[model samples]
Target: MNSHHQIIKTSPASLFLFCLLILPLSATCNVEKTVVARCIDQERDALLKFKHHIQSDECGLMDLWGNPGTPDCCTWKGVSCSNPSGHVIGLNLSAAPYQKTCLSISVFSPSLSELKFLKYLDLSSNYFYDMEIPSSIGSLVNLIHLNLSDSGFSGDIPHQLGNLSRLTSLDLSRNDELSAQSLNWLSQLTLLRDINLSGTDLSEATDWTQSIGSLSMLEVLQMDHCQLSTPLTSSSILYANLRIVSLSINYYINSSIFQWLFNNSNYSTVKQSLEYLDLSYNSFQGPIPNEIGNLKFLAYLNLSRNSFSRTVPDAMGNMEFLKYLDLSYNSLSSTIPDEIGNLQSLMYMDLSYNSLSGSIPSTLRFSGALETMHSLSYLDLSHNRLEGFAPGDVEDSHSTSHINSSNQLEGPIPSSVGGSSPLLHLDISYNLLQGSIPSAIGDLHSIVHIDLSYNHLQGPIPSSLGGASSISYLDFSNNYLEGAIPISIANLKYLGYLDLSNNYLRGDIPCKLEITKTPYFAKFTYNNLSGSIPIKLSYLGYNAFEGNPNFHMDKFQGRCDDDKHDGNIYLGLYVSIGLGFYTGFWVFCGTLTLKNSWRHAYFRFLDRIIDKIYVVVAVYLARFRRKSQV
Candidate 1:
């Protein structure tokens, strides 16, 4: 009876331990089975059907689809599936590293629409040939992103695309044959935030701007090169949330669009949100409105290749966040405002090809306590009439500087130039700058191109210039620089274009300057250089050495032998001709004197020729007289 009692107690403890382990194990198995069942069989079959329709899989990405050994379709390349449900939601076939694997589907496949839960589809940069976008794509109501850019699609965009009301981004750019006869369908998609229709024909879509403005949530609108000519109505309400707008390469005739965009009463939200505005390559005329300063968030503004005139507005300095400002290729006049120094974040400023006249502002030098505009890297003021000294203290390291053509900048080049900044390109040609070039110029070790031509710079060519090992183009032509050509110039291995012409440089051309594999362009014309030309430099043509009176061509005979031999050949021909003429004349005279029959035959032939000429002249004179009488 005591042993039975012990067994009952042990049995109860064992049963408790069994329930603790085996019951939880059974629940865990059921959970795993439920997770595996979430990957629906129907969705896997649909993905397999879609892969079979891909006419070309050059990248071999479709090999994983529908393999029974790997039953999960969620692990396929360029595909994404929802977490637990395991439904296909995204398919991206953008041609990136494997551009050769571009799809070339001749006909649009309806199998893709089978993925009912798909929200993102990208097939950009492929070779779909001349097939139209499939009308059946509208069946995907859950799609929020669709990109078919540069896919070689032709014909009209389907109106059925208006069904995708949830789409936030749509890019159909760079399909040259793509056309949109009407954009009335775009109004249905209110959730669109970005739209890029560049290189598509929208000439007939006169209400394109209005249609786009209706989407109040739109942030980016790019319609470049669309052959658009219609002007935006002054009273039209533009999208308030727009941050980027590119309308370049169009033919809108009116400048009033600017007033409508910036000066409109309803554009307060747009002015604050707009960041990038590109209106380049248009026919815009008249003064740029001062009201543009209201856009406090404007960072990039490009108005180049237009007809904007008058002074640059002083109010532009109020845009403290402006990073890139390009106003080139315009007829703008007047002085660059000192207020320009207020832009603390300005990085690139190009005001070239204008009629602006006056001295460069001292504030632009960045030398004073103002301490703004320090980020300036690229500054081009070429082809203008600005005068006075070059900004001496303007120090931006590795800056590309251009002040060439018709400027009256004078005085010596600043010694501080190479001390602070390693210049990339420094061109100050066609200016009135005088005084010797600073020897410190060699400190710009990163200098690539240097042009100080058409100036009054005098004194010895700096030997220190050879320290600039990266110099590719160096021009000091039309100056008064004298002394021997610097021997240190031979150290420039990267010198591709070297011009010291119209100067007073002397001495023999350096043999080290001769590059055989890729010959350097060298011009030393009208200089005082002497001695024999280098044999390798002879290929540069004789004009390179012309006007150098002391240069001896005969000393470099190995290279000039062909030219000398050709001259000798002409001399021999002349002598032979003269000797032949003398011999023939004497032979004829002797024959006439010794043989009377030969002389008479020659005289008879000459007489016949003279008689024919007289008869022809008489007939022409008679015809002229008869016509005059009539």
Candidate 2:
């Protein structure tokens, strides 16, 4: 009974030891199984076959596949395998790093479909020539992300792609020859979140909007330059949950497309979720719909390069989140709305190349408060017919302002321009602006380009302008600007383009002007500049110094005639020569006509000279004749 009790107690301890040992042993077996679970033999063979079709691999991307010792394809460059199953789940042979490698293949092999477990595939930025995407790719039903963008693929997008129900992102953009005959297959990919078909042909897919709209979870749809002519239907439901929709450069000529897109049943949803909407480079005409403001979440709006006529919608102020607004290259007319000043979050605003008229709204000017577009860094209202005083208090420190061309703005440039704001580029050229360039302009230490050309701006260029050390381009041409070129201008180490032509500028060019550092485009033509040009500036052509009568060009040709009295001397010499000629002609001719003896003597002298010439000619002819006889 004692032995039995002892054995039973020891049994429990022995069993515990046995359990620890067996557990370690089982773990070792599992480790061995994982080691042996390398890439499947069939899948490895498929990869090798696929590599064989690669006509060229400058990056040597396929060197590891079937390489002497490296038999496992999971260890290859762009292959990923599952941890336990060891199935190839990802193949990313994107040519982003090997820019020089032209990875061409005559045919996309069906063997790629052998990677049945593949969930991610990216062959972007590779040159596949004109090979069509194989329909066998549909065999990868587990694929969640497939990107073949800019891969040189052509032909029809296989309808079989719809089989990837789990696909979340599909990017086949920048394939100019790729086409989608029908998008009905896309209706199957209900979980797809993003689709980028930019630069593809979708003109024939008349039901694209309807088919794409059915993807209720779609977040981003980029189809720029897709040849899509069909307008969005009123029933299109694609706007829901769509954060970005880039359909620019399409063939939608009618303006009603906006009405359909913004007035749809899903407008309310789009207003809340939509962030980026690009309909630029199209033929959109008529006024921009006031309903555009309904997209409260919109951040970036680009309607440039269209024929959008009439005033910009005042309702745009409602988009409080709007940061970038570009309405350039359109025919938008009427006064810029004061509502534009309400966009406090606006950073970049471009309304150039339009017929917008009337004075610039005072609200656009800085008020030393945050209620204005205080965040605005770039403001371009160029190439318009706007007339008004220059906005005096534009206090955005880092702003670049351009209000060029045909603006009838009159008055001195706002003195606060360079003094208060850290203005970088200020171009108010090609206008009727009159007044002296404010001396305060020199305070713009950060100014890079300042163009006040082609205006009636008069008065001496402020010596303060030279204080702007960052000035690279300075154009004050075709104006009535007078006075000597400021010596301080020579301090501009970055001065690349300097034009002061067609001005009343006098005095010699600043000797300190670093001609060698001057840009090739430097022009000082058609000015009242006098005195010899500096030898350092002699290399410049005469055209640069033309119309400056007092300026000497002979010095450039190695002559130093700096005679201050040369002009008066030449004038006196010309007068004397004229008088002498007049006296000699009259005296000789009158004396010969009035005195018969003098006339007869003159005739005899002329006859004698004629006879002597005839005799000399006759003698030479006779001598030549005699020589010929000999």
Candidate 3:
């Protein structure tokens, strides 16, 4: 530095730009240390002869093949090679963890069509006991994703898989004895985009919608329980990128297949790439159409158990990215449409066993009055025939957790019922609901199933409902509820199913419910509860302390009788043995049919007596002779 060393110099254009950037980064670190290619020894001996015709590798994936130094079948375990053309494209043997693997379609081998660049094949939930998906897998033909679902494949599906033609996602769902007679060889696969013949058997295909309408690159058409009762004609197969249309448990009673799947002038790109529309348990009846609000990007709309009747359509609140709306077990009557609260991205709304009557729609936070579905979570209007007055205006809906408005609703439960829930299942059972039992529903500390049973609900039972503390199923049965049973619901540590039956509830029974030991269902029967019973609940005998007539139980003494003394001793012992067998069977057949001399002196009685005497003498003599012979 002291000598003014300014003679720095490199030649030929800075040594040719430093050897052209270190010779392509030293040839990309020697091509990134190469190795990721060793698969093809004829596709690793055709996957070791398909794992030596595995008779059952319960998915131990053929013991991960020769792992001593990793004899690389593209590093095994669901092999997928082809870095530098090692070529065994992909073979994911799905069914690990939880599906509990069971591989054995003889390990699906027809020498795996020698992996001619196999393109993704997942043998899902393996156990092909009914085998036959192998028409040599239509010679692979570079398959593009084919998952044989729930494995256990069965016969007839092979029209040589329409010779692959670059299949794009074809899951033969569930398998249930496969079938699919003539889907006209699926119109030669025109690059199908997701076609799951769920629980296949396509009822002899009937050219299955003209071979899925010649799949104009269809998008997810799951034919659930494919006994598909055809009936959607006029096709040009315009599935301009259709998105998830599941004809669940098929028998689509032509609602014109919803105008041929919302055909806004010949399937307007399936209502803008329809998103998850399932015609559940199909026998689809009429009236879901307000043109289904033009499907504006629908998100999971299931017409449950279909027989869809009128009225749910206020143009389905224009969808607004609706999330899971199921018109349950349909017979869909009127009134639920407060435009379904304009679906602020609604989350799970089910009109249960429909006949949906009025009330509960204050902007649809169902009974929470009006939080306007701040992402409502599971609201089921149970067994509907609904009447009014549920709105006590609970405050904070915090994404409601299951509120089932059990039908025939009447007044009074609204004392800020759990203040708008963090609720976990609260069903207003068979309602005519009267008062008292809502100590804010114990402020629903994550309540767990609370059903105000057969209501005409009276007082007591709410020691703040044991502050919920994650209550586990508590029902106030046939409510006319009275006092006592609340020792904070016997200190609830996850109390399991407790029903205060035929309530007029009296005292005792709670002995801290024997210190909260996960009560596997305890019902205080005909409550007027007195004492005795809880010697650790005496193994819930005497039908959980029968009609409490001073409820005793040194092990159910005197068997707790009183529903009018066991219905008057079983109605006077079935009416005194049915009136003493109807008066000795009509007085011995009315004196032998109105006495024809007492029916010929009870007939043969006389003849029989005489014969008996004679026979007796003869038998005595015979017996003596036989004894002697013996």
Candidate 4:
């Protein structure tokens, strides 16, 4: 206000300097913006092409990258771009998440080629059938990962795929009648680390062997359900460097190849580096060679559900590093050797469903180390004839008891067994057992499943079992157990399946039957249980109470005509009675026939005599009438 100093302050030189300072940054930002816009437009075009390739009833133009209510192909599900500046780098227009069956490959958008910079592609689990793979797929040079699994793709793999030099992973599994005609080209993609060809039902060209031989640097290869008719190993180059491999569930598959591969007879320089192997559900037979001991690095092995039979090789126990071993459902026989105890690192071992007989090896006792072998979380010895000393059966009673009532083995439930084993599942059913459930079982709180059915077990169910909080499945049926059903069983909250039937036990249903955590979970059924059916048991299926004759249902009525059980017993009873009486009744009628044969000549004589007598009586009556009239 002192001197109205409103002089104009214009600095032309400073303005020019500022503009020069900001020019480079603005140009870089503008460059990025232009690149992003161009990429987005190309992505949209690519999506449109993809939509065109998809069949009707599959995604259409309206639901694809198009505007709402229209078949705009860009705004579709599973469409992604790399960065603002990247082309449509990902496209996942798969049909797995949908259950509709309409599938036509011609509906796929041809504009997908516009995504020239695409790096990832997934068209897995689409309900497509015999759709011709676009030869243009090879043009996606920037693709790093591609998955077309379970798309019902057929025909030969396109050699054009070799053009994807940057690919690191490719999965074309679960196709029908697809052969690896161009798999050799994939070997050239040195960056590829994983390849899955499972369930492809590949042809018998034997080209697959040559193709995989070249992938020296591959880390993981899965060929399960590939319909490879030959043994798995047909290697031209040694897979000594291979890490992870799976070739399971193939018909006519074999471990003979593995046996040959691991042996020095074929490739002396080869030393197997495999850590995991699965040769299950095959017909491989013969002895497990001793050289298998050389696979010291092996941690997991599965030879289950196969036809292999013989004594388990002692060499198996030599691999002290084993964590998992499954030889179940096989024909393996002979006593398990004590050498098994060498696998102190073992966590899981299943020898169930085998023909192995003889005493359970003391090695399983682990010298009272059973409680500390935490890694051994699951052990199944079911459905086998394993005989052994009952827990605490050793000579010295003062010594620490080894065999505990951990299992319901026959002879007797050694009360001491419950003191040692905290086993999760103990099933010793269908054996020549003669014993009562030991009360000591109440001490094993960690138990979850118990099956002592089909044995000679007797005695009341110990009240201690009610404290088994984690129990879920308990079966003591087909035994001699007696006494009233214990009420303590009500404390089992986690119980989902309980079968105490086919025994002599009689009692009123425990009131807690209504208090199951799951209302209709399961019930005490098929037992000698009487005193009215538990009302809550109405929730169970009708078949659940089949063997319990006294059980009744208030609403039960006759079943439909087709129901097999409909009046079947009554009808069978009538037929049996009729058949049983027919022979005797017919034999009595034969007696009458013999009577006629014995005195057949007197029939007319008896008739004559009877006529004479009748005539005399008539004459007398006539005379008497005449006299009365006179």
For each candidate in turn, give its C-alpha RMSD to the true structure in angstroms: 22.6, 18.9, 25.7, 22.7
TM-score of each: 0.78, 0.79, 0.36, 0.68
Which pairs in model 3 have colliding backbones? Answer: none
Candidate 3 lDDT tens digits, 1-630: 532222124344554555566785655323223233677667787788888877877647768675667777888888888787788788897884546766766546688888888899887887877877888889888899988888788888888889999888888888788886788888898988888888888786777877788788888888887777777744535576888888777765457776576653556667778888887887878788898787889899888887879788888898899788888998989788777788888778878898888776777544443456677766878888877765546676755555555677777877876775576887778878787776877888887787778879898877877777777777788879898876666667877677788988887765546435464778788877787776556766677667888877654323333334778888899999999999999999998998898789777797999899999999999999999999
460 in model 3: Cα distance from truth in Å?
Answer: 7.9
* Cα TM-score of candidate 4: 0.68
What TM-score would candidate 1 get against the native?
0.78
- Superpose all Cα atoms of candidate 4 onto the true structure and report the RMSD in Å to 1 decimal: 22.7
Best by lDDT: 2
> Which sections of candidate 1 miss by over 4 Å?
1-71, 97-101, 365-370, 394-398, 403-406, 514-520, 535-543, 553-630
Q: Give the TM-score of candidate 2.
A: 0.79
Give the Cα lDDT of each candidate: 0.80, 0.82, 0.76, 0.66
For model 1, how does the per-residue alpha-carbon lDDT over 478-547 read when each residue is reduced to its tens digit? 9999998877787777888888999998887765565433456888999898987777676787877888
After superposition, candidate 2 runs with Cα above 4 Å error: 1-37, 58-71, 97-102, 366-371, 394-396, 401-405, 512-519, 533-539, 557-630
Q: Using lDDT as the measure, what is the rank order of every candidate, best first?
A: 2, 1, 3, 4
lDDT of 4 by residue, 1-630 (tens): 322122113255544554467787755333112223233665675565555655564444235346656332333567665544555677775666675443456444456666787888888776556765667888888999998888777777788888888988899887866776445786677777788888766646456666676676666778877766655453445455555566777757766666445643434433446677667666777765666666776788887887777888888878877788888878888877677767777777888887777777765642333533335656666666677544552111211212122332446656664654456676666775776888777665667777777878888888887877777778887888888888778777777778887887776666555435453455456667656545555577666656666656444333333344557978999999998899788777676567875435455677888999999999999999999999
Model 3 lDDT, full chain set: 0.76
The C-alpha stretches of model 4 lying farther than 4 A from their native spots are: 1-40, 52-85, 92-106, 176-191, 232-235, 264-272, 366-372, 389-424, 440-448, 493-496, 514-530, 538-630
Per-residue C-alpha lDDT of model 2 across residues 557-630, encoded as one tens digit per residue = 22323443676788899999999999999999999999999999999999999999999999999999999999
